[model samples]
Target: MNSATTTTTKSRALRRFALHATSTCATQAEAYGKCILATYTDVRKDACKEEFAKFGACLRESVRLPRK
Candidate 1:
């Protein structure tokens, strides 16, 4: 491919990597949140559920961002 095409492909790849990294970081945060929630017996299950929901929402929102 030509230089212009290569550059565009590279840019897209970089953007994908950045988004993947952000999602991964968010996943790590959710894991840590679950650990904190696990410490409390009363709300442990609900806390874990909420953490998963929050992570899902983050991913969904990220997908919608570039559309607007």
Candidate 2:
């Protein structure tokens, strides 16, 4: 496929991972923070920045999950 398609797929995966990590966090806040970074930082910087912001806004406004 093309670069746009590839980026979209990777960004979706990153958002999924971030949500999973955050949702499954235990008592420790640091662990959750680390998980967010490990799962999303580079992906957001590379190809998911716009999508990430949209995802985050939706996440905050409601319980809606990211679209595939």
Candidate 3:
């Protein structure tokens, strides 16, 4: 497989982990602030910036607190 394929797979895995993680958080706030987001942004590889954005989008879509 090519580098693009590898990066895409890894990004998908990151999103999957976020989904599973949110399902188990003590609170939506906890899920929203899951450490992986920060860690990924802080240490991201330049080549995978697009994939990181995809991961961020997945978190935004999957890990929100319910409206009051």
Candidate 4:
């Protein structure tokens, strides 16, 4: 395949992975978003550390691509 075809295939794969991850991690993402929104006015460092950590972990697990 040419460079353009390869690039398009990779892009589509990334989009698919992103969509899957978003759906799989929706709960964790919502929690993190709520934490940020709740503290939006008075943001503090590490205020949402727990929520963010959970969200990150979910995304990491959800988006793992299998090796050929």
lDDT: which candidate is best?
4
lDDT of 1 by residue, 1-68 (tens): 56998999889877865785476457755675766766766664455665666666665555453755
Write down the lDDT of every candidate, Cα atoms only: 0.64, 0.54, 0.58, 0.86
lDDT, model 1, position 3: 93
Sort by TM-score, top down from the best: 4, 1, 2, 3
Cα deviation in Å at residue 3, candidate 4? 3.2
Q: Give me candidate 2's TM-score against the actual structure.
A: 0.35
True lDDT of residue 38, candidate 3: 60
Give candidate 2's total backbone clashes: 0
Deviating ranges (above 4 Å) for candidate 2: 26-68
Q: How does each model score on TM-score?
A: 0.36, 0.35, 0.33, 0.70
lDDT of 3 at 18: 66
Best by TM-score: 4
lDDT of 4 by residue, 1-68 (tens): 56998999989989977886678888988898899999999999999999989988977776787669
Any runs in candidate 3 off by more than 4 Å, and if so which? 24-68
